[model samples]
Target: MTSPRKVRRVVSLVPSLTEAVAVGAPGLLVGATDWCVHPAGLDVVRIGGTKNPDVAAIAALRPDLVIANEEENRAPDLAALRAAGLDVMVTEVRSLDQAFAELERVLLAGCGLTAPPRWLDDARAAWAAPPSAPYPPRTAVVPVWRRPWMVLGSDTFAGDLLARLGVRNVYADHPERYPRVPVAELRASGADLVVLPDEPYRFTADDGPEAFPGLPAALVDGRFLTWYGPSLAGAPAALRAALRRAGPVPSPRRP
Candidate 1:
């Protein structure tokens, strides 16, 4: 049998969770993403990105622990970090339920123990029953990029996220991991919201407007909505906030 783990100070390799832990679990993070702009005053050392992290820079931080995701960081990169004598914890989250479990695990590692707050279970339960009245399910096509256009299809974390938020996925019919298709397919999908993500490929409203003329399109913070890491604890609440901000869709009323 293997021995237990220990953690003192940590560096989060995942950008979305960097802010969540910065706000949710403070003073424990010593390293974060260059894109991690939360907390306003806390200065965290940058350790490159989820894809191409600077191992030398990370070694300089001298952290006792590191957090990474299976889908976010490639296998070779994770192997390199492990070879460097850094205790790395890797998580694979394919659904919102798995996302919640990841956040709890992070909390356990950060605190050097494995006890979870009771409220977490309650929080997950709250989502099962929508507050007030249930709104009409909105069909959304979340595009991560253009040019060899990619979209979140069935069995993906992004697709599961939409299901949790009461939004139906327009690309549930597609079977590919990240399919490349034409704009003509999008026009035929009849999606209510053409959500443009900010990462992998930044989609600005100006770029997608003409492509999705009559559709309700918006540039959304992809990390918060999609990344399943320690930040997942805040995602349900964040989704609710986004739903309120977007308000109700006038056109394409519920069928």
Candidate 2:
């Protein structure tokens, strides 16, 4: 009988996946970026940032498998790695559902076996039914990056996640992907919540309530709220927790 091939020694180029594997399946993570948190003090070698990994440094790790995300990585780097004869698998997650599936796929492929995190079911349930009574639908704005000010457009994971939360998207009106808008426009939104993600851009209360004063501001964890993967299972609940912290959506109540 032929022996089974060993699939050990992994290099994770995706920030969310790197954190997931480090928590879901540790020890095997031979390389990750400085942004890869979770698992506390993971000594895995540093490659580079999520968008642009130091391919040479990663190659030195001699990883049998390299896990990266299509959304987080660039084409040129991937092409370069392919030309170098390195085995790299990329996962592109446009929605929350896709994120969960991809995380499971990566874990199974890299670790041979893995258990779905407990948060998965909880997130699903939370999304299906929030704690609030009659969970009134709300319009909201999800900003991923600033300066130019990128927002979560229709059909994206951020949009879907908000939909799951029983909130209607304000930018659903726009057709462009991650379109930029003026702050003055944001101040005039019909949205009840101005979701300020911790990443892509870090917005603080000091930034001024006038920026989003009329609407209640929600400070959410960008990783959980945006990154879909094994991490997704926990996100809905994290969102719920954030919502709870922010309290029930008030004002502009429907008649």
Candidate 3:
């Protein structure tokens, strides 16, 4: 385990982890995936997408550590990096608590930091309490993709985030983490709202809301909904505002 002091160079495959690492220690990152777009003017060697990183290019960088996610990066890619003698720190974040803990582990334990970053504390403070509601929590279907129609299902970080925000993911109890369901099934899933994010699919107000004719659709920032980094600090407020502005759902049409 290379200590944080010894970790002068890093290659990050995960976008969220990229932002987290870059924000925590600027200039420590020498390589990152093309999707690792945060901290705005980040200048690093692009290693391709999360699923298809150039292992040879990464190995050539001779990074002290490569940060990845269990769900984001393929095992074979991580193995190839390890085979090239690169140390890989893989993180698993399924829920809010796990996200915080895993982040601390990556920064403090993996990066060997003296203390957790201030943004981590800010994220914690931002989501300290569940949203106060006047009515029962709204039931929603959170779609990550459209063509195949996969949705956020069971024990996911995004689902947990929505739960904390007083929105219940209708498919949270489904067997799969991201289940592919037909558009008609999703529309008839008895959801009170359709939470559409702008990435992984880029669902806009005009693009996504039409599918669920009578249901309110909240077009949210994908970074807030999916990315678990410095953005976590503002995610709660941002998501809540989007939900509040969702407007009313029209009455369901009779068959």
Candidate 4:
């Protein structure tokens, strides 16, 4: 049974959410998943990975709340947590707007914070206006994985972020959120660039860029591209730096 009093303890299963709570209320989290890598020196009990958390260990922590993401966590796992009498807060963030709203919901309501965090405000401000330097509109193919080769499709937070950066995803109209496409199809997508992030599959400068030799591959921080947390504050500048380094951005400013 969940306590009606103040939430004194928390266990986060989502990496982004763990960072958000860890930053908002230090020491509030007694337990977090192995993937919760933000707030650098976070010292907490490691439950397990996002997809495969140790439910027994998490319950043993006796947390006031357990945070999870709809996309990153499985339904049965969430169900198991709830069945174990844990107060689970599952979040869904498919766009930048949703991120801010969900963050507020999770931090203020779920964790019982008095108000919103400064980083949330800073993140909002960072994306308040599109950058002054606008490149000619470009299209991109964002591969989250290789081998089987899954890419971001429609209604995704990262795709929305890229769109805000003025880069349209070629697969934005696909029916599935994350779809698998053949390497040949991805190569022939005619996108101006390939935006690759360094998580889910760890695409690096050497590893990912070689896949799309014909297109300029921008190896980006997956945390910035995907995670909606403290990293969001500097994502615009960080991503801009990476994207600018990619061939298509500019040799000289339009000014």
Q: Pick the candidate with the highest lDDT.
A: 4
Which lDDT tens digits does candidate 1 get at residues 102-139?
Answer: 77777665545455554455546655665431257778
Ranking by lDDT: 4, 3, 2, 1
Which segments of candidate 4 are over 4 A away from where they belong?
1-5, 249-255
Taking all chains together, each candidate's TM-score versus the true structure is 0.80, 0.86, 0.94, 0.94
Per-residue lDDT of model 2, residues 1-255, tens digit only: 434336678888777888777767667799998777755788989998887889899888888888888777888888877777788889978777687677777777655554565555554554556445224666678777777777887667777787777767789768886888887787677667777778768766665334776567777888777765455666667776666565557666578
The TM-score that candidate 3 achieves is 0.94
Candidates 2 and 4 compared: the better one by lDDT is 4
lDDT of each: 0.70, 0.73, 0.89, 0.89
Worst 10 residues of 2 by lDDT: 126-135
| Higher-ranked by TM-score: 1 or 2 | 2
Task: For model 3, state the Cα shift of residue 144 in Å.
Answer: 1.0
Clashes of 3: 0
Q: Residue 166 of model 2: what lDDT? A: 72
Model 1 scores a C-alpha lDDT of 0.70
